[model samples]
Target: MNKTRSPIVQALLAEISTFDEAAAYRRMLPAGCYTEPEFFAFEQAEVFSRTWICVGRVEQVAERGDCFSWEVAGEPILVTRGEDGEVHALSAICRHRGEIIPCPEKGRALRCPLHFWTYDMQGRLAGAPRMGDAAAIATLRETVRLTQLRVELWHGFIFVNLDPDAKPLGPSLAKLEPLWAGYEATGVIDVPPAMSDTPLPWNWKVQVENFTDAYHPEFVHHGTHDFAPSIMPGDGVRFTDMKPGDNAIVRSVPMKTPDGGMMKDGWGPDAAFPAIATLTPEQRSRVTFAMLPPGMTMMFAPGTIAYTLIRPAGVTATYAGSDRVTYGGWLLPRSTIDLPDFRDRCAAVREGGSKIWAQDVPVNVGMQAAKNSRYLPEGIYGSLETTLQQFNVWLLEAYKRADQATR
Candidate 1:
């Protein structure tokens, strides 16, 4: 155990060490892992800071000079498209006095609000008013570029890493590549999610566990999730084998009918958005959900590829947004976008997603609240909960690695 970790976190790590691979499948991690502020602080420094966090879609900065401000691991960063037509992720803190710099309006340089220090889209210092003479200003321009983070684009999703020497994000996500070809074949376009202003009162893990759980839909989401039942007649939920370096925890459930998707009532046969003609017969018959730990969740449906971005704010505070949480995190083909009733279809999908979300809210709250209970059980997992178990394993590995590094 790392002596640097808080006593609570160290105790949790000791408990985590007792669970071998097979044993991990039978029990959940200690409740303190979810409920303790000290453990959350350790996670922020160890896990999240080193992981690849999905920020937004590539379409958000499609054109040169397009940029947006985002926060990763508590550091405000700017994602921009430069004159060279490449995407770059740079620290948003101004080089001079550390005031956070917001993305400027189109065709304008990123200017600090405090002193009008300006930088180009690529984060190179362009001007600093009243700091020095001509020669000194030129020297400052040569030496004062903002710190750049590592960026990798995976299937149009923009991911950034705070760790300078962290391994590439692609190989870890190779499992998800096979599922993407069909969606990309017809040329999909992203409609990025608008994050909620208010945070949800739950641990980030609790939010994702609710998203990945397959056993609860029958009881919890009676009407809305019936069309995509986890317990189908012959084929129930199918899980992918997690390899050593794998990052995604995935499960797919058979749809009641081919091409079924989100409707006004919920997931059903008469989907608001039409199915993509290019998808395989198997793809059309099932809905695959993938959780990329520490940041995002994705749904591979017949009509559209839906996604949600997870942002953890505190030990029990998480903020998320997507089709289910808020509105519009969709990737659809041009054919669907060209439909005359596309706006109505989008609204219907949002309405259906809202109903499903309403059921999830209370259950999530209850799950988070249970962590504080004196009698919280070492939870049992059924076969249907393989994804959750996989998530536990992933987190354990991250925690272990961080602990070993500190030693």
Candidate 2:
């Protein structure tokens, strides 16, 4: 096995070297991780393909007879729910002539329109017309089956892994189960998922970093951002940074609540939905964001819980709802409470989300353009940028693991 690392990969390793908590927080990840095509391809195979990649919610295909077709980076995928009450992901390419199946095709079986080959919901061959003799048909059926991905559902999120032997997704996110234990799993309905995709001229990781890093709000979102009290470094509010191998991050900030009390609190309870009943006093007092990498973030607060539907586009871009997905804004921020029966409240959520997302596009695309610039500078993460440092650490570790596996 080839154990040597590519210059690009080696550059990444050295850039994101593990540092002490008090160490200067240099932009640990290399700029090339976003700009170089080769590095992106490595991530595609090593990270996206092998890891438990979050695609979308099971609500996308809720009906028992429904199926959804997907294509990412030329790899055709099909997800369907069988009558047996199970969801499955399989290759959407026809085994006979390699034809792509149309997306979201319904019914019990996937019948390739071009050829008459039919496959059951579980992806087992059901029928193929006029294949000479019974022996030939049986042999083809015995050996041919759609490639199946390892899939698991966590808190209504559907994640699929190309690697057949990948670890269970639940255990990987063990640290998060308790933090979010307060949420009523049943009450959290799929509120008409708000999915948006826009082209970024920068690497997908930048979006991931900017989302949870509280430091950026001081400038990037300066005037337009009205919801959260804008905070800057040396403001006496220190965020907790994660050590290597940490899968999540949580930080509490001091804010004045609308109830006329000067206490650390969440986004104003009035503008937000009702708090999850089970949240403890501290949990309700502040906002928390948890991540399931290489790019999934879950934000928890008294009133709302948000997540991204990210999919990677390439070296310097992303297509949310699909490869590796996100600016945190339009990335599906749902209320912790169920949507009220009233349409106005739901409309408010939709309208507010649209406005915020509009403000994010220029910032993201500009960052993308800057990443490919004459002055590629390393950023120093302040105490407030702990989330960024933690995420970057996770990114580096994932790359190292992927590299080691290749070796």
Candidate 3:
């Protein structure tokens, strides 16, 4: 782990929380850092190829003998449940002729249709039906184990790494462990196939930057502010410098009605300004939001509940999926829950939120286009933009390593 940690990164992480003045920070960037083609190429080769991406929900392959298959960065992967009942990630391609196995969803064994080769739940060669002799069978057994990838299960989320040599997820994420303590998440979770597609012409980073820009809430989510009557008419909320070692805490206070009572729907009279009802009473009491890296944002309100947004796909066009669950850690089968209807509700929430976000897409795309113009050399960010800076630094480091490797 120390080998992967660089001094530059250490220094940067230590000081980010105390940094002030978004304008001074903007001067530090070289021109075209956000919109250039070279950066995009590096992202595809280095970042997406080597990292453990959260491609799907944990429940997708939760049961023993269950499996889920998906492709990432053009690589086919099969995540399977072993006989021991632990989930494992393996390359979906058969060692022979590179044919894909574990086709068409979860299955007891990974069987290749092209050659009739079979691998057990653990990915060991179970049977090879043809061309069998003493030497041939020995050769087949020795070479046929499915290529394994690093997999980690944390808080009911599944992550897979394409680089077999990458570090396990736990140690890399150790710094964030303390922040998640005590949040109630539904022990059961799922990402329904139904998802809204908001195709933004803007770069992926632009979309992420928007997620952290809470300063725009009052102005951009105007519908929310306009319809609700309790919020103050025009208070522009701004988050200040976010410190690295600072205890994970939410910053915004839920808006209260002029009458000074908690609003039923968590919003003030101002349609856009919602009383920060999203936080658990405990978390709201503390005022904190967990800014997870490599593309996940979470908001928790104490014991009440929590929501996480994960970027399953890579930067070109990532899929933002959320899990709203409790910390109780209950494990009930899908049949026990009204999964379909629940999925519909989740879809509706995301779609509604996205319709609001759609308004920002053009602004972001125009910003991306301006990156190439002499007019926008670099741009300023605010305290609410702390996560924005964190993301850029992370992106730069990922690029630096991959760049070094190529050289």
Candidate 4:
């Protein structure tokens, strides 16, 4: 397995750093990167495990004792807000004897239902009755703490890193803030997250690529054009077309109803969030969907804001971070959309996404199968796919570093 991957690994390490921006962006990642089981294992370990992955917005753990839980990269993680109003992410596996514990079950303290070993919301060993005398208990308490993962908050999003020493997620994504400035200034609130796992026979990157690039929306999401008229491709550049270091893929789309009618703006003049007063005239004409790859994205519309997450489920299935989707948002004060109506609108988008994803999954399945053909072209990038190419570069860099780490 190592021998087969040697050349691919080396090329990934070398090409990412040296690939000329001036050159044509016709090349694609190796087809095997999407189809090979061995490479998938490498990604689970090297990329997803080590990196800070977003677990949706902090709304999942907004109040004291609120919790969110999921399994990623083979490890079960638990996240909750403590009495002190601090959020913590920790190994959901109990420390006493490495037992698996189901989570998002809340109480004043986290109690392992199996053994009754208890941990505070902050993951401190709170109690283990009948284990010892005072001296022995003191020592045991010090050694039995939960394996805490690093948690960072940015613009209401919650990200947890399995690697305690990883770089700060904020500074790493500082440039992305500029992209969110207008929405942030308007005092955005999360819409209750809606998540669904779309099972794919191909690798997860296939979906990430689909999300980050504007190229496919032309054909794959052709229906989106009627509702999100910004997707109507033309000589103009799409917002998802961005350079590296931005750490974001943002696309601009018009706000339209399903029946092919354009709103005066995203929310219309009578929206609960009528329109952000701070948005420029041009900005008001478009709604923005922005993603920070692998897990987090926010769809900022004139009337409402939404937060979402996607994490890998094994090698082929992708989890919509909260199992099926937990989404929330603040309505623009001027907009007339009510909470009940807003909820329904969010549900419609979520359902629409699922419908669109059904189209993408088969397309990617074909791409995965096409790898076996001699005529399969390595990615031939178009100009609009700079964002997609940037994501590819980041993916290669991650694999290259992981390769180095193992050696």
Candidate 5:
């Protein structure tokens, strides 16, 4: 254990060390890992900072000079499309005095408001008003550049890492590659999600646990999720084998009918977006959900690939963007986009997502609140919760690796 870790974190890690995956039944993590501020801080530094984090889709910066601001592990970053036609992730803090630099308007240079220090699309210093002569300014331009973070594009999703030496992200996600081929063959376009202005009051883990848990849909989302039953007659929820070094914890549930998807009520046969003809018969019969921890979750449906971007604000505050959380975050084919009633379809999907989300809100609140209770049990997992167990294993691996690095 790292000596710098607080007593609470140390105790939590000590308990986590005793976890045995081979046991007949798996237990939930210590509540302190979810409720304590010290552990959250450690997680931010060790896991979020060191790992690959999905920021946005590559389509966001499709055109040269296009840029957007985002935060990763509490550090402000600017993702830009440079003149050279390469995507770049740069620190948004101005080098002169560390004021946050917002993305500039179209056809303009990024200018820090504090002193009007300007940087080109590539984050090279362009100007520093009234500070030096032309020669000195040229020297500053040559020397000053926004710190560049490592960026890797996987299936058009842009992932950034604060650790310069972090391993490549693609290999860790190899298991998800087979699922994408069908979606990519038809060519998908992203409708990026609008980040929620208000953070959800729960640990980020709780939000994901709620998402990955297959057992709850039957009880919690009774009316909304009946069509995609996790406890069906013969075929129900199926889980993917999570291997060592794998980053995704995935599960798929059979739809009541082939090609069924999200409708106004929720997951059903009358999908708002029409099914893609290219998907395999197997793909059309099931909906696959994959969680790329600490950052994103994806849903591979017959009609669309829905995704959610998670940004943790505090130990108990998480901001996310998805059809269920805010709006958009859909990957649809061009044919769907050209439909005259596309907006209506999108609204119906959001409505369905909202209904499902409404059911989740109260339970999430209860789960988060229980973390502080003395009565919080060492939870038991059922066979339906394989994804949750996989997630716990993933989290423990991350924590242990970070701890070992410090030692």
Candidate 6:
């Protein structure tokens, strides 16, 4: 590893003692760590129950009578398309005996497989088998509405909130209204199937921190991106001077000079990346990056608008549901771009990105392991690490809340 360090790195290292507060907080997250109880506590209460989680793509249950079953934060939930053509989210467990309603190959109604108890697509008890008389049926119906999970469809993704009292996803997302409104004006949005799962030995915060640390690219992905003469010009470099809320948006441009032998200059050799020219002035000002409260990233490139869907499986494991949308607005007729091709290409890029991430994952694991050691250094924070610090604060606060509730 390069021993040469930045003033920021030096300042943080010098103050390590100030940040190590395990009793009041927990272990400090080093460059990498394997365990974090703070992350686990948040997952149990807020992330698992209170927040609206993105479970799957909206198109999964597009047709009326269609349904999709998913497990989020250990809760079995199902989203179904009602005969009336509305989408509904409901607890997948049967109210009768806590039996799970199995998702059939294709169906609109939710039926409990164990006792043949059935609920409408809206989660109302529609029928009961052999249990009671007609007079008692009304009582059963009143008693057995499937617990509803707050679900909202945005762009082409479906987000569900375990907390009934939580702010609606729409108003919550109103902060990004400009991006969404612009996307709708541009064209119809399309979503493709996403393949993702949780990785072992890394906290969710660790993953987000890694994404923000663009400084590691050169050292971590050196073999794939740095050494590849076709992709890198010289000894490859990582971006410095990172700011919070800044996004490293990426896109492919049609070769200007017919594949000028894959320019090594990262992003572009000149200021004008051919692709940006294709966008409107408004699009030019758009920025893409990940937002907080435990979710995926938002991308607003010249012609595309989308957010990746992230669900933490455990304190240290995460799953991603990524998709995108492109529209022409009033200037151009609206049309949605098919994303299979885009996702496949991005997947390759993400694959390359993952190698770089692999280098940081160990750091999180190691930090967790060394946290209990008396010799372990205190953690440090910088402006760029504000997000990580904020996450830690949020997690610790959550533990405080959980403890208060218990007391």
Query: What C-alpha lDDT values do all the predictions have?
Result: 0.92, 0.61, 0.52, 0.62, 0.93, 0.51
Tens digits of per-residue lDDT for model 4, 1-407: 24445565445444544544433254676666665565566677778887778776676788888877776677888888887899888889898888765554656577787778888777888788788888887877787888888888887767888876677778667655655666666665554544554544556776666666666666766653345543444523355444444456666665543112112222233333346666555456556666776666655555455555666665556555321133333323324344457655554544554555566667877766786677877566776677666776666557666766665
**Pairs with backbone N, CA or C atoms under 3 Å apart (clashes), candidate 1:** none
lDDT of 4 at 348: 55
Q: Across residues 220-279, which tens digit of lDDT does each residue of candidate 6 receive?
A: 545533322212333222222212222122221121222121122222222111223344
Error of 6 at 97 (Å): 0.5
TM-score of 2: 0.81
lDDT of 2 by residue, 202-258 (tens): 676876766666766546544434335436244334465465445555554533342
Query: What local lDDT does model 4 show for residue 74?
Result: 70
For 1-407, candidate 1 gives per-residue lDDT tens digits of 77767898889988898888877788888999999999888888888889999999889999999999888877899999987899999999999999999999999999999999999998999999998899999999999998989999999899999998889999999998998888889999988898988899999999999999999999999999999999988888999999998989999999999999999999999999899988999999999999999899999999899999998889998889899888989999999999999999999999999999999999999999999899999988888999999998999899888888887
RMSD of 1: 1.1
TM-score of each: 0.98, 0.81, 0.70, 0.81, 0.97, 0.67
> Which residue runs of candidate 5 sit more than 4 Å off their true CA positions?
23-25
Clashing pairs in 5: none
TM-score of 5: 0.97
Where model 4 places Cα greater than 4 Å from the true spot, the runs are 1-24, 226-235, 239-246, 251-274, 321-340, 347-355, 358-361, 372-374
Error of 2 at 362 (Å): 3.1
lDDT of 5 by residue, 296-333 (tens): 99999999999999999999999999998989999999
**Model 6 compared with the native: what TM-score?**
0.67
**Error in Å for residue 337 of model 3:** 7.1
Error of 3 at 29 (Å): 5.5
What's model 3's lDDT at 338? Answer: 53
Query: Per-residue CA lDDT of candidate 3, range 9-42, in tens?
Result: 3334234323334433454344344554544444
Clash total of candidate 6: 17
Model 5 is weakest, by summed lDDT over 10 consecutive residues, at 17-26
Residue 283 of model 2 has an lDDT of: 60
